[model samples]
Target: MHIRKDLSPGKQSLLTTGSFLIPLFLWTIVSYAPFIWHPDIKLQVSADRSGVTTVFTAGDRVSKEFFPTFSEAIRVENQAIMEAREQNKPIIGSRRDNLKKLRHLAPLAVANGWLEVKEQQNDEKLYGVWKGLAEGSLKSTEVELTEENIEVIRSNWRLLSAYAPTYDSKRYPTEAMLKLIPQGVSSNPVYLPAPHEVIQAGWRDFTTKPDNDMPTMWERYRHSLTIIFWGFTYSCLLGIPLAILCGSLDFFSKLHEPFIDFFRYMPAPTFSVLFVAFLGTSDAPKIMLVFVGTFFQLVLVIANTTRLLEKSLLEAAQTLGANRRQLLKRVIVPGILPNLYNDLRILLGWSWTWLVIAELIGEKTGLTGFIDTQGTRYNFDRVFPVIILIGFTGFFTDRFFHGLRDLLFPWTEEAQTGAKGPITRFILRMSNHSSYADRTKA
Candidate 1:
């Protein structure tokens, strides 16, 4: 709790864990609690809009205001069909359409334990479910079917039965069918899917093979990591020596600093078009954009860190009759290793921030490509996994590098500062005292 002080490791780890957990805890509450910030309804069962190509399947969420409107639209259609039948004029639809219509209740049947997940589109199984429900042989307890829906099911079952006494896709009725009314539970907006939902989505995406020629989730992930690795690697290759030379010599500093300072302000994305034209639309442009975003800042920050090295240390090296090359190679480079390592670690993360922007430049690729496409399509649940993956990759990469610093530069203040908790110190003290007592008795 003291100013400019590290917490005991135990407390620090606990608080670090809490930092992530607290946000997740809040999200879960907002998602699950109906009276909380559930401004939308996540569909448990869903239906199609007439003449609309956008099919909202089960698990799609709609705003609460829109849910009733959506459900009512289906009801109106069913009601019209009902009136048509009573008047001895059946509104016959395409047999294919009727077949698709019956399968719309598959989600409802699945939810009510009347249909297995794999059997959702199984029209034969679904037809039997409708018969059972209409005849009262099966019932829905988990999610009670609305009274209106029960009527629709019975009416639809009668038409379907007379068309064919049992399940027969070929002989299924062409008479217009009832659409399942959209049903859902309270939920947060699509942008903030629940934790289990995110997990399920992540698992599905990572495990499932994507359609078309698109790369799998893990392939996209590896591509993203490769981009980061190369971009950061190229920057370090070129920037470090220049930065070191600039920090150690005023001549090099005056030569490079002015142009770089101005160039850094130009913003990396502005050159996206230029890069694409010069490099063509491939990974080359994307890699360059990431490099451009990170390189200028890398030079400036490392130069400053290099300059922060102790003047006394340099003076001692010079007083020992070391020449300029000796001071540059042996003193300055060796002296700044700890700080330089930290600077590179931070710049590595900076490159990640530019990944999405870089991916957008020409042809979208990598995890950013998937994220951009999904985001544009408003599939935020699918998008969350990639975003979370990027965040975790950067976090763990930084932590891994930070841990390495302790072993690599044990002389540094940060490495030496593994503070002990009070309980840990107390236990050690008692153990030492017991050892001393035993020694005295001996």
Candidate 2:
């Protein structure tokens, strides 16, 4: 088997930068020109609700007055219904008033190009029985417009709300338009908001915006980071020692290999319920989940890395009057340090994956929990930012650790070209200076 050396520094940087920037460019184009895959304009209808649910599109410029009009209309309608009940009068007058307000607002919105009406037969009200197919026949009660069906309908509404905005705008859309007046149709129409709108909603929902009772994004992230750190800590504590033992002793490798492989194949989520049952829905189970995800995998990786150390090096250390302990520490462990650091860096990412599931067990605190809640509410704008935050955080963290590895282990072949780069050297110099200053003060 031929081993490939690291790419030249210039080639590596070019490839890495291109890999990210090219996709980013394409994504931006897709976001602006969403019509390539899906329609540029779509009206999502909530089957249970009446009227136009939401306007979904990119590049729309909605007038500033649209939201105030929508709000005023809703307010007037609610107030009228309340007064009608108090006065023991029919709601016909209130209904007429609501209609009049909408009648006035609709044309203004349409004329301003904020709303577009797509003609539909019977006004796009979906009322067919959707049956599931089983054994080449339609199941009579596959699904219908029951409470369950209502949920399904809502899910469709949410799906559109979430999907459209993701590719709608490279930046954010400012359209605040209303469409398909719901006077005779339904109570609430689902609308695909612009990216900016979603981001603002996410900020409010995930931050300390006074009215928001949920934990801030920072709080959730801190909780998640805490879980990942502790889990990784435990995994490193147990895994490194076990791996060293396994690598040093053939018997230990044979003894634990099958067991490690067995659990490695077992998905981490399978143990979620068991972990919750044992540890309760607190942070303990989540931390355990991360530990389980990282530990066995790390042990195997470290063991393999340690096993690859040169036998001649070990023999030389032994010949130099080193004991078994010194040979293990000074030879085996040090030999694998660079690769081991890289392994831990990669495993830290897995810890994040497990973190998502772990946070779900108890009160939703992390970015994942925020996503779940916002997604259900069809507030996809909020969801996208948190998702982006995760990826963005992971990307930078990976780069930081990658650079740190080169800085710490300059002798490693992989570190040679990467560390010699101007950017890496600058960062390395800053880091070395910081360390030196700290030592001098101490």
Candidate 3:
């Protein structure tokens, strides 16, 4: 007899560590590399200022402006240098020309000035610039050089000239500079939402409040789940029995085949619309939508399973002296059990997909309705989480039925036993030792 050698503890630990690290390394490379390399802009402040000046980033006190269009500002600065050099003397020129040129080149300076003056004065005159820009009153052609504008322009130029070397170097200020800047005078740094904000935004309020009596989030989830569950269940119940009857009886088979074929081609949504016309936008229409969507597929599955079972095993049972009822109970059902289970799984998945459409038009409460509401309100955060939840829930439910098939029909040679049978039994056994032992003994 040969004894199988298990992996040693140290080797196992090393293997597990490697396994975990490999994926982590891959995920880090795949998911985080881009974000690390190039961070996205969460907030943008485009100041219509005079010259290239200090800009504020989140958590940073004063960083140099990095606008692509700031080349015009540099050109103006170069022109100013050339003009001053051409004079060959400290020529005290009118500040208005430089100010106007600066304002044109870097409107961001104007915006920055406006922001600054707005902080000091509670007057409407201070807000006139921003309000004009926002309301589209200040066009590119109209350079309204007011007293307020000149003061803002002069102040911004001074600030930008002081910070010019830092801008050229692409270097941020020290902590000392950040601390020295007064509140509301320093640039306003916009903060993006933290992880907690993102999480909180994902939750939706669906329940009835004092102001409004609408369904809750839990209610919508429960309603959708119920619709999917019952729709598949009732479809299977009705379709499978009828299919079995039709397949077993030749006369019934001839009568039902054409009708089934007709309905299979007829679209469910069309029928749902008709049902809504008849039943109104009540629960009946919603339930009927799910039913119609699932029914045809269920019929096709059940009919095929019945036909196959009958052709293969029904004749065998009959040759072995089995009656009609006996054949159905023993041979027919047993032969078709795996196929039926497969059909059920397919229908369940289909039902989940269709339930969305069912709730979209007719139902008051469901995932589809919730998604629609969120979409109308522009709540993308809530929509994505619900969609993710639906996908994961469907995956787990399909896997569950696959596990169920293996557990109940293990005698079949081709039955799948993927991590579900022995593993599940082992876990259950650990939980209920006496019951497990009795089951094993039996």
Candidate 4:
């Protein structure tokens, strides 16, 4: 309640928790509460259209405006099949295709607790699900089947049962089965998947082996980290020394600042093709882009921090007969190191801002690449998890570094006023005064 004052640690932690929970609470309300802005129907059961190759399974979302049209499309296809059956000229069905349709219910069965996740492809297990539903043995608690869909379930079960008491893929009937009616509950648009839905999707995608020889999510995550590591490390290698020289000497400052100032104004992305042409499409260009995105501003900021060293510190060193080398080594370097650490930490986050653009420069790779691919396909559920991964990665990284700052620079105003974490206390105990077992110098 005090003005311009830091709150207690308990209050700070409470506020931090509330910051995240507030948004999550609003999201849950939007996603779950019936009277909220849920304008779409998230499918709990889905089916294939006769000629459409794009098979929508359970968990797909469609706008309320469009759901009726989607339902009618499948309804028309089913009526045509029934008429064909009545005329004793049933459409010639591929046994494999009809068997595939029965397995299509696998997702709904899993959702309804009628089958296990792995049982989706277990044609026999899924057949049992169909029989249970048809005979009113398995209840659809989470997602009730529409009256039309229940009838389709019974009708399909008849064809399946007549073929055999249990599933036999080779013995599947050659008669076309009716598509289940699409049924769903109200939901937000695709971009705003429910929290539970996101959690389920993230778990499934992360654990399941990716198809098409692409990298796993963790692989992509590591690749991103690698690019960031090299880029920031290289930036430090060159930028830090240049920044130190520029800050400590007028000659170095005049030599470098104007050109660096001019180059930074040109957007870093404009050099994308140039970096690719010079380095070729791979990690090299991506690393270079992150470097470019970070390096110039890094030089300017650290140089300014260097200049901010108190004049009395440098004047006193000179008066003590310390030469230029001694002044830089003893006075200027130590004077700026704390602030420099903070500058580098801030710039590291700036480098991450370039990650998405950097990854897009060449052959797209890393988490950003996965996000680009999934986003373009409108698989926002999958995209959300990756995005959340990136955010968590960055947020916690900054937090970890911030935590270390107090331990690393205990003489600074922040460290002097702030509380030390257990890791900090343990590290100080190990390094500073600990000698005899369980005792240290006062």
Top candidate when judged by lDDT against the true structure: 4
Q: What lDDT score goes with residue 279 in model 2? A: 89
Q: Tell me which of candidates 1 and 2 scores higher on lDDT.
A: 1
Off by over 4 Å in 1: 1-7, 47-57, 73-100, 109-126, 137-143, 167-179, 417-442
How does model 2 score by TM-score? 0.63
Q: Per-residue lDDT for 1-442 in model 2, tens only?
A: 2368767778888998899899767755555454433332221221111255564222232333354354345445445544664686624433223222223322223333333543121111111111111121222221122343243334323322343433232221122112222211111222444445656876775665534576778887777788888989999999999998898889999999779989899988789889988888788988898999999999999899889889999999988999989998889988989988988899988888988887787666677887888788766667777887888888778877877777678688766543354546568567687754543354
Best by TM-score: 1
**Residue 224 Cα positional deviation in candidate 2, in Å, after optimal superposition:** 1.4
Superposed by TM-score, candidate 3 places the C-alpha of residue 228 at a distance from the truth, in angstroms, of 1.3
| Decoy 1 TM-score against native | 0.84
The Cα RMSD in angstroms, rounded to one decimal, for candidate 3 relative to the true structure is 12.8
The lDDT values for all models are 0.85, 0.61, 0.57, 0.86
Work out the TM-score per prediction: 0.84, 0.63, 0.57, 0.80
> Which of candidates 2 and 3 reaches a greater TM-score?
2
For residues 1-442, write the lDDT of model 3, one tens digit per residue: 2378656667866886798689657634543344332233322222223333664322223322433334335445445544654676423323343333332323332344543522333223323443344345644332334343344334443433454432332321211110111111122222222323325655434333324676666777887888787777778778888877776677777888778788878778777778889999877777777888888778767777777864756677779999989987887778878888888888888888778888876554677786788777655556755675688789777866766675567675545323334445655566678865765565
Give me the displacement of residue 283 in model 4, in angstroms.
1.8
Evaluated against the true structure, the overall lDDT of model 1 is 0.85
